[model samples]
Target: MADVNPFYLGAFAVYLLIVLGIGVWGYTKTSDVMDFWAFGQEMGPWLATWSFVANFVSAVSVIGFIGAVYGEGYTLMTHTIFGLMLGTSGLYFAVDRVRNLDLLTFPDIIASVTGYEVARPIAGAVLLGNGWLYLVMQLVGASLLVTAITGVPYEYMVWVIGIVFIVYTVLGGLVSVAWTDFLQGTVMVGAVLLALGYMIFDFGGFTAINQQFAALDSAYVHPTGEGAYTAIGIIATIVAFFGTIFTEQNNIVRIAATRDVRTAKLHLAASGVILSIFYSALVILGGATTVALTTSGLAVDNVDSAFPVLITDYVPTGVGIIIILAVMSAILSTTDTRLHSTGITTARDIYSYFRPDSSDDSQLRVSRIATIAFGITATAAAVNPPGTIIELYNFRAVLLTSAFLIPVYLGLYWAGLSARAILASIVTGATLGVGTEIAGGLFGVPSTFIGVGAATLVLIVGHFLLSDTEPKGGTMAGD
Candidate 1:
């Protein structure tokens, strides 16, 4: 690792200070739980759009996916980018209905759609689990970057970054998160473009870069790389990513927070466009890193460290810091959103259900407490993450999509689903999702296909068998 640059440390400090300032400002704007949880449903298209983009494009995309591309070639990018764009387009179909529901949390949407009080807690649990794992992924990616750049111990950097975001989240909730996301989103775009341009120029041109990368190893430019990626894996990756967009609380909250359905739709469309360009650039940059490292006779022990190593040792210091800040931006932007959603899911979905008469003030207090608790827990987990960043992300996405995709989306438009069916779907999906994921996809079939498939089958079967005899949970709240 390069020596710690004082200039980089100074710039990082200033950035953290700016983030804290934004949190304080967001606190001033927040007057109640509504403001904290949903930005008071006052966000316009611009802020909502950027916030959506920032939250979706986390450390996983910028750091994890980039590393995957560096190691695995463009196959990973093809599946993930296609899945993401397809999922974003799917959001357009649900925006008007989802926004009009006026829900505060994903669990609330589930509860409202199912009319089963029990469904709220089950959905909340799934959400919290998903958020915690994803939060750890963000922290792991950020900690790696900061550690490589500043030579800070990874364990200590994990807590430091975790505590900073947790404090702001406990202070301002979504208000702080949205504004910071907008800023972070802009920085992320700039950083990616800068890195991409540098790579292009350094290697002569796009074609030359690919030619050089191919010279090192044909597999570096091969579609499947070293054959680690299979046809089944690619299909599963797409389905998992696509289904995740429907159930990801962070993304759903942004849509619900928008001023109107039109704004929400606009946010989704714009975010999708920006993310497409941003991710494509990252794919190019990943290939460039391969060529740069090989030509420079450098090697990284952990593939996940490829991006940080490239920026810190290969790129100019000024450009490197910008990309570093972009990594920080990606980390903080996603962490705060996950922390906020986890808190809200705890307070509004689970806590409030047990105490239905709890005042808004009471729920808000619990929300902050929950945020702090989860933040600490996630930070601890990040110190020794359970798996690679992308592996952890895939697990989170598969579980959430399996558990919530069928019940939430189908319940939105269909009215025949019973509480029993919804509950069965949640339980079955989560169980199989975890089991299949742990079993490494059950004979090359992705956990997503099995879990979501089983969930859908169970829901439909349960509905047909039980809906006629059992009482429906009543129509969705808005209906």
Candidate 2:
């Protein structure tokens, strides 16, 4: 902990107040379950685009993953390429179709396509699990930013951040989340761009960075640089992230919120371009951070401290506050979405499935309650975070993708997909995916690739081998 700048603290207080004000505004606009969950499907294309980009570049990307780029070297840039590819797929494949669907949540689509009553709850459970995991990771990163700037205890800051999120999200739901996301997204881009600009101006340019890295090792400059990542490793990383964009509940819900299919496409297209620039800047900033830290003779106890340490040591306090707010913006934007999505999964996907007779009004009430419950649980997990932010993010994304990836894509396009086949795929995929991840580097590929591969194989084999009935032609939207 260190002494805080009065101006920095005052600026952050104002930012939080503004965020709360937006939440209150959203509370006024939200009327029912549909409004609460999806903002009545009235989102503008640019708003949706910014929301998607903000969610995509969460606290993990702003802080922890940037640290990874610096510590791990240029080879890790493959993940950024994978993220860009994910955005492209969203534009061409996901946006048009998902927005047109009558379904409300990912589980609704799952059950509809598979024609299974059980699939809904299963999907809900996985959504809740992964959502909480991601929420916890963001909270950890947010608390780190808070502690660094305000000199607050990390444990205390975790609960404080959680409480503020719960208050706004519970009161306002998706409407609040979306509005806040738009503002946060704008701030996030500007903050990061400024940080990058400052780094280039203060530290030497790319040539100087390379010279600094040369003193360390030449591999830092190479694509397939020295580290744990290989060609297969890059593919595996790509596969995990690509699956996240397509199959994750939080992302899918954003697509469903778009005003129309055309708007969805436009939003996705715009998001892809924005993300490409954002991620490229992040990668370059990572390289610049390594150079800055080395030249300044700063001692980083943990690699995850790179971004925060760089700002504190090299940048002025006023500018540091803006950068920290940017980090907060990234964390809050993503965290609110996970919170809102978890509530929807619990109330709409799980509870409503079990109690089909429940009214939308009661469901809305339950959703608000669930939002608070999830916030508390995630805050507890953040108190003692298990890994670096990127590790948590990647593992949770892989877990959800393993369970849903094969079934979701195949269900969308392949008419013959069966409920039984989906069950087998999810179960088998989880087993192999977790097993591979547990087995570590000796397994030679990311757990996501292994798990997704297993799921796809089982699904295809079972569809051909097990079904004696004739081909059933139907789309996920219709089913």
Candidate 3:
């Protein structure tokens, strides 16, 4: 390992203090389970908007995504950026309805719409599983970036970052997560813009950077790039991203926290626009990193190291520090949100299902405990990740979208969906999705399509078969 830079360590320490301070303030404001999970349904447009962006974009975008572009070319843009935009568009129609549900957790919405108390725990289980994978991905990406820049061992960085975020999240829940996310989101965008400008200046222009990147490998200029990403794989990835609005608990919680339907819609629209611009900058920076590394004859151990290596070795100290903070912000923002969501799922949906008469204080205590437990577990897993950051993200997304997309959205709008059918959809979709992923896709088809397709089929057939047996007077929002 290289010698650690005092300046970088100092900057990271200051950032942590600032976030922890915010967490303490948030704790002062949080008094009940509602405040912990949904900020008492009082978030305004700007806070909700940036929090949504920070939670969604993550270290995957800053570290793993830049690395993907450096290695795979522009094809990843289609899989991630375009897919994210498509997913955000779907949220435009969903926010108003979801916000109107007046629910604390995503699984609560599931139970409300299906009129089945048992549906809550079933959906909560899927949320916990997906949230765990996503939390691990964020920690892995953060640790990789920190290790590359600070010369710290990956395992130590994982524990440090994990413990810090978990403490803050447990202290204040969504209140802390949202406030800190706002700060992190601002830092992330500013740092990205700064880095992008510096890279463009160094390369002379965008076209020059592209020319140099293409010269290194002509395949880098192609839409599909040099990766194993086939057209079908790209499409499947896009669909998975598009379905995130329907299934992601973090996003759903943000929508639910907004003060009104208008605020929720505004938040989604603003976040989508900001993310589009942010991701576009990242793509350019990716190409620029390719040019810089090739010209310097420097090679990275993996694609995920591309951004960190560029900022640390190639860029100036001040700019590098700021970019490092941005990467940290991306990691912390997402990790906190995921941690909080996972905790809420554990307490509100899963635990409450088993003990329906639990008091609000009891649930709140359980939520904090669950957050700490999952945080420690995820930190341990990050020490030895199962796969690359993007790969883990895609796997979680496919499983989540497949299992929850049809049931959550349809249950919200279609009153005819029986609780039994909804439960079956979750099980079938999650099982097939995980199975297909383990098998490396079903004979060339991506797991997203296979799982979602199977889930949809199961939901429709099960509903029709059991509609008469189950009484259906659920309070579906659309109904």
lDDT of 1 by residue, 171-197 (tens): 899999999999999998898898799
Model 2 lDDT tens row, 313-419: 77888678778878889999999999999999999888887788999999999999999999999999999998888778778767877888787777877776766
Candidate 1: where are CA atoms >4 Å away?
473-479
Kindly report which residue pairs in candidate 2 clash with one another. Answer: none
Q: What TM-score, over all chains together, does every model reach?
A: 0.96, 0.94, 0.96
* Candidate 3 whole-model C-alpha lDDT, 0 to 1: 0.86
**What does the lDDT read for residue 143 in candidate 2?**
86
Name model 3 segments beyond 4 Å from true: 226-228, 475-479
Error of 1 at 166 (Å): 0.8
lDDT of 2: 0.80
Clash count for candidate 1 is: 0
Candidate 2: which stretches are off by over 4 Å? 80-84, 441-445, 469-479
Query: Candidates' lDDT values, in order?
Result: 0.86, 0.80, 0.86
Q: Quote the lDDT for 281 in model 1.
A: 89
